[model samples]
Target: MKNRSFALSTALVCALTLAGCGVLPGGSQKTTVDVWLMQGSVSGEFLERFTSEYEKEHPSVELEVTFQQWTGIGKKVMAALESDDAPEVIEVGNTQVARYAESDALRDLTLESVRDLGSEEWLPGLAEPGSINGSQYGIPWYAANRVVIYNKDLFAAAGITEPPKDRAEWLEISEKLDGNGRQGIYLSGQDWYTLAGFVWDEGGELAVERGGNWEGALHTEAALRGMAFYQELQSHGDGPKDADEVTPPQAEVFAKGDVGQIIAVPSAVPAIEKANPALKGKLGFFPVPGKTLEAPGAVFIGGSDLIVPEKADHRAAAVEVVTALASERWQTELALTMNYVPNKTTLAGVIEGNEGTAAMAAGAARGRATPNSPQWAAVEADNPIKPYMTAVLQGQDPARAARAASERITAALRP
Candidate 1:
C-alpha cells in the first residue's frame, strides 16, 4: 500500500508540475487525467508513445500515468476509491471489475459501451465479467486463454491430418498418438482451470448464485460429468495426480519432446521453444475441443479491463482516454507490440499471421471467467477445486469430494 500510495503521490506532483506549465495563452488550465495501469501490462515505449500522441492531439489536456504492481492491488484500489482524490481511470483484471463495482466505486459505462464503444463487437469473455446485473462498469481491454498446443510430427505420425473439432475426436486422436513411449497429452490432474472448461462444456458451473448468494455447483450432475471427462482425458498422459501443472513446470515437461499436446496459454510457446530449440517450428495449436462442433470449448479468459472511478474529477476526459486506448488503432498497436489478443473479436485479424496468438484469439471468443463474486478471490486463495480434482483422479468418490469441496467453496463465497 505504501508503494502504491507513493506512486500516486509522485504522479500527482508531476501532474501538477505539467499543469502549471500547460496553461493556454487564453489563461485556461489544462485538464489532467490521472490513470493507473498495471506495471507489466504495457511497455515503457508504448506508454511514452501514447502520452506523446494524446497530449499533442489535445493541447488542453495533460496525461498523468502511474504504474502499479498486481500485489495487494485490491486493498490499494479500494483505498483509492474511498479517497477524495481517486484516479480518473484505473485498469483492473477483467474478473475483478465486479468486486470494485460492488462498492459503487466505478462509474456505469453501459451507455458509452453501446453508444461509442460498439459493445456488440467486444469479446464476451472480457465483456461479460465487466458487466454486472445489466450495466457495464469495466471496459474490455485485452484477453488470453488456453489452447491445445500439439506437436506437428506427433500428429503426422499418428496419421492425423487435422485438429479435432469436438471432444470425441480430440480423445480418439490423442489415444492414437499415445503409444510408443510418448504421452498423448500432458494434462495435469489438478489443472482446475482446464477442468472448468470441461465442466462448462457439460453445462455445469463452478458456482451458482441464488437469491444473491453463491454456492458451489460442482456436485451437480452436469458438473460431475465434466469432472468425469477430465478423468478420462488424464488417463491419456502420465501427469502427476496430486500436483497442478506448475509443480515441476509443465512447459519444461512438454519441452522434453515426447508429449503430443498440452492445454496452455499461447504465451507458453516461447518458454517451450527456449527450453527445447528443436520444437521451434514443430509446435502447432488449435482451440480446445468442445462437446459439439458448433463452437470451441469454453475457456477461462484472463485479461485486464479499464474502469473509471465514480469519484473522479474529470470523468469525461477519462472516458476519452479510455476510448482511445481501447480503440482499433491502439488495440492493434497493443496486440502487435505486446503479443496480446485485442479487446474485440473484430480485431482478431490483426494477429492473423501469428499462429499462436491467432489460435488464442479464436478460443477467446468462447471464453468465460470464473464466478463473478468479490469474495471469489477468497475462494481462489484457498481453492478446494485443486484438491477435489486430485482426489477424483486418485480414485476417491467424486461425489463425496465434490460435496466437501463445494461446501468449502460455498462458505468462502459468503460475505
Candidate 2:
C-alpha cells in the first residue's frame, strides 16, 4: 500500500511542476484536471489528440493526462484516494467499480455538472457495475468482450463455411479441425473469462448472493452443467491440459493456420494484422456460440470506467472531461483506432463494416459484468476457481472440485 502511495506522490510531483501555475490568457487560474488512464486501453496518439481537442473546446480548462500501468492499478488508486493530492479523474477497471464506489471514494454523478450525462447511452450491463445504490459513481468508457476469432484458412480446410452457431456445432467443428498435425480451438486451463461466458449462457453463475451473504455459485446445477461442457472441451481440445495455454502473438498463432480458432477480444485485430500480415484476408470473427445454435451467448464485459474523486478540487472540470471522452465522436475514434466496443448504442452500427466489428458490437449488446461485490476482488486475486476447472479437466470429479472451490470462494466473500 505504501508503495502505491509513494508512486502517486511521485506522479503528483511531476503533474504539479509541469503545470507550474498554468493560467488563462485573461490572468484567471486555468482549472487543471489531473487525469489518470490505463496504459493499454487507449493509445498515446489518441490521448494526445483528446487533450488537444478538449483544450480547444474548453479554453478555461487543461487536462494533465498521465498513463498508468495496469499491473496493480486498483491498489494505487485506492491509496491515492486517501491523499490530499489525488488525481481529479481516473480510469478504473470495471471490476473495481463496486469496491471504490461502495467505499465512498468517488463523487456521485448526480452532482449538477455531471447529472445530465444521459446514462441511457451506455450499455446497461456495463453501467450496472458502477452504480452505488441508485446513482452512478463511474461512467463506462471503452469495452472489449470475448468472441470466436478464427483463421479462415483453417475453417475452409476443415470444410467449415460459417462460424459455429451452437455448442454442438462448435464441438463438431473443433473435432474436425484437430487432426493431421494441427490443433483446434485453443482453450486455456485457467481462463475464467471465457469459461464464465459458457456458464452464463447456460444459466450458471460464478457467484450468487442469498440472505445478504455472497457465496460461490459454481456448484449450482446450472453452473455444473456449464462446467461439464468446459471440462469436455478442455480435455478434448488442442492445448496443454496440465498447464495454462501459451501461444505466440495472436496473429502469429493464427497465421500458422493450423490452430483453428480461439476466444479473444476484437481489439486483437490490429495487433494480429501487424504480427502476421499474411493473415489479413484469412481471419474472421463471430460472437461466442451459445447453448442454442441460433444465437450468440452472453459475453463477459471488460473495460475501464471514468470516475471523479469526491474531494477533487476541480470536480466540474473533471466531469466535463468525462463527458467529452464519452461523446460520440471520441467513442467512434476509439472504435476506429483500437477496435474497442463503443459505449453508446447509437455508435454500435458505426463499426459494422467487418464481421469482427459486427461480432464485437453484438457481444457488447449482451455483455454481462461480474457480480458487484467489493470482496470479489480478493476472491479473484486468490484465484480459487481456476484450480477447480483444472482439476475437472484432469479427470477429477467436477462436483467435488466445485464444492471445494465454492467453500474457498464463500470464505473470501465474507467480510
lDDT of 2 at 109: 83
RMSD over all Cα atoms, model 2:
4.3
- By TM-score, the best candidate is 1
Q: Tell me the lDDT of model 1 at 279.
A: 93
lDDT for model 2 comes to: 0.78
Local distance difference test, per candidate?
A: 0.90, 0.78
Q: What are the per-residue Cα lDDT tens digits for candidate 1 across 1-59? A: 21232223434544666644445445677787889999899988888788889889988
For each candidate, what TM-score against the reference? 0.93, 0.89
> Residue 327: error of model 2 in Å?
1.7
